[model samples]
Every structure is written in structure tokens, then in C-alpha cells.
Target: MAKGERPKDSRRLSRKKTKQKIFFDEVCRMTKLVPKNKLTTYGAIARAMGVDNYSRHVGFALGKVKASDGVPWWRVINSSGRISFRPKDRVGEGTRAKPFTSLQSIKLAGEGHTFTEAGAIVGWTKKLHDFNR
Candidate 1:
């Protein structure tokens, strides 16, 4: 699919047994559908994929994507509308020496997404793209 193109029929993922690679691919596809200046929660993607408990897994799959893959991984945030650290970032949630000024924040800011002084995206719910469309 072209960049940002939603899967023809994957508004929600199938629950039937599938390979882990397929699950990862589905996550990538769903993520591609998020608009440029919009956002979505990891949990929202998991729920849309029929696995509400898999938000962390969603984060993992997104983390594995390369920049060339056309997945806007920065458009995803935690349910609280805050940018989160990946396990590999070596920074625990509360241990960031600085506020949310990571590269991801810069990217989101470049796209017109606003954030709080502490780094939480402002008007997050209004910017969310639910993929059902």
C-alpha cells in the first residue's frame, strides 16, 4: 500500500489465529492510516486490532519499523497523551533527565502538534484519528 493508505478492509483486525509477523504487519498497516498531524494511542491500536491488552506489543512492533517503512510511529502516544520511552531508550518512564523534548516530540511539533510544558500532547483527543473512517 502507498504511504498513509488504510487497508481495504482492516478497520479492525481479525481475532483468528495468525502468525506474529502478520500481527506486526497489521499493526504497521493500521498505523499508516493515522493522519499526518493526528495521533492515536497504543491501546487504541490494540483495541482496533482486537487485542485490547496488546498496547505494549503495539509499541514494540512500531519500534521495530525503519524510517523508510513509511509508518508515522511518532504519531502514536501513550493513552495519557504523553510521549513514552521505548524499553531500548534506556530511560524509564519517570527517569528522563529532561522533559519530553525527544526527537519524536520534535517531529510531532513540526507537524503542528502542540504539547504541554511537560511534554504531553495538548488537545490530544481532538487530534486522534480512529481509523474507522
Candidate 2:
């Protein structure tokens, strides 16, 4: 079978599983990075942690982690510096895109990070670290 193909009856884990595992590990590590409110991209973590060809795998891994874990999964985003939109909520629950963005912005603001009218970081993370003294 090719890399993308899966055989029947063997219960083989998909290739995505491996990348997800790598992603999970990276997320766990990222959770430990200092100065809360600092955002890291999927590509940043992938390259820092040595995962090859698996930026989306980082997002997938974060989605799978349990909420009870307190993993700060919101900090990971695309390379273009945008946070991931929340997955559609369960029945009767409300959800919104850019949920993490607001939280991140608030946290960064407490640390004196600035944002434009469109609500971007505007070098907030670096500023936070610098302002921390």
C-alpha cells in the first residue's frame, strides 16, 4: 500500500496519526514557553520540534486534545498569524470564529500589547516579553 492507502482488517493507524502525535508533543512543549499571551504558529512549532511536512497536523493534534488538559491550545495558529476558528459547537451551543484571538488580545493588552482596528497582534508577543522587565 502507498503512504496514503490503508489496508483492511489490520486496523493500521493512518499516516495522520503519526504527525498528530508529533503535533501533540509540540503543543505540550509550547504550553511551557514563557510569558503568557505569546502566540506561536503551527509552522513555528513544527520547525522548532522537527516535524517534517506537517503544519496542519499541528492543528489537528490540538483539536484532539481534551479541554480538561488546560493545554492553552488556542495559542497555535496558521503561518499567516491568524488563530484557528473554533470547531462548530455541539447542539444548542454557540460558537464563533476568532475566539482565541480575543482572548489572546486581552491577555496581550494586559501586558501592554497593542492592536489595530482589525484586532491583530501588532508585535504584541515580543512587546510583552520586552515590557515584562
Candidate 3:
């Protein structure tokens, strides 16, 4: 290898990390556009970023954001307009379990969002912000 040359594998890894950082930054920017009283879906953000159907990547990027960064991570939810919490584990005793209360729901409620008994957002037509529009 030349004195200034990096290993091919190391170069590829560096480029991958750089791309991930760019994706994460774009996700944060889109999340910021969701106003206090409005919401957007992970799929929507992915679409806005020109990567339609990459909702899980959107979620992964948002998960990397720190609470103090002011990105409003809670404003993003599943495509069905519900807070997407990981399901609680059920041990072998045959007892039902529930996931912890969603902080995203709490934040959205404080912004005046209403939910159905099953927890889908109500009046979604008016509340869901379309950044592409």
C-alpha cells in the first residue's frame, strides 16, 4: 500500500459511516418540520428523503438522536398513525403482558391529539402533516 493510501475495507467502512450520518441528519431535519400540533409517519419521512419504503431506516436514524437535540423524535410514528412500541415479552407462565405507556403518545396528547380505544390517532386526516405537499 502507498504511504497515503488506506486499506480498501477501511475506506469502504468509512464511506458507509459517512452515508449513515447523512441519512441520520436528514431524518432529524424532517422530524423538525413536524409542528407541535401535527404528526408525520416514518414512511413519510423516508419518502421525503427520496427513499420510499425505508421506514425502519428512518426509525433507526431517529433512535440515534439525543433527547436534548430538539429533533422532536416523538412526532414520528408508524404508518398506521400509532406509537410503535416494542411489544412486551411474555414469560412461560401464560400471563399476558403489555408494553409500557408510550411517551410518544403522551407528547402527542399534550399537543391535543386524540386516540381511539385501540390507540390509533383520531382525525388523522387533519393531523398528519405531509411535508411533500
What TM-score goes with each of the models? Answer: 0.75, 0.57, 0.83
Can you list the residue pairs that collide in candidate 1?
Answer: none
User: Which of 1 and 2 is ahead in TM-score?
Assistant: 1
Best by TM-score: 3
Clashing pairs in 3: none
- How many pairs of residues collide in model 3? 0
C-alpha lDDT of residue 71 in model 1 = 87
TM-score quality measure for candidate 3: 0.83
Tens digits of per-residue lDDT, candidate 2, 1-133, equal 8898757744546656675575587667664463455666766666666665667766776777676877766555555554455453122334575333345444446756566666555764453222122
* Residue ranges of candidate 1 with Cα displaced over 4 Å: 1-18, 87-100
Better of 2 and 3 by lDDT: 3
Candidate 2 residue 88 Cα shift, in angstroms, is 4.5
For 1-133, candidate 3 gives per-residue lDDT tens digits of 9999888799789999999998998999999999888888898899898999899999888877887889998888787878876333122233246544766677778988889988898977678887966
- Candidate with best lDDT: 1
Steric clash pairs (candidate 2): none
lDDT of 1 by residue, 3-114 (tens): 9998876654443334667988999999988989889999999999999999999998888988899888989999899988755443224545653236687788899988
**C-alpha RMSD values across all candidates:** 10.8, 7.3, 4.2
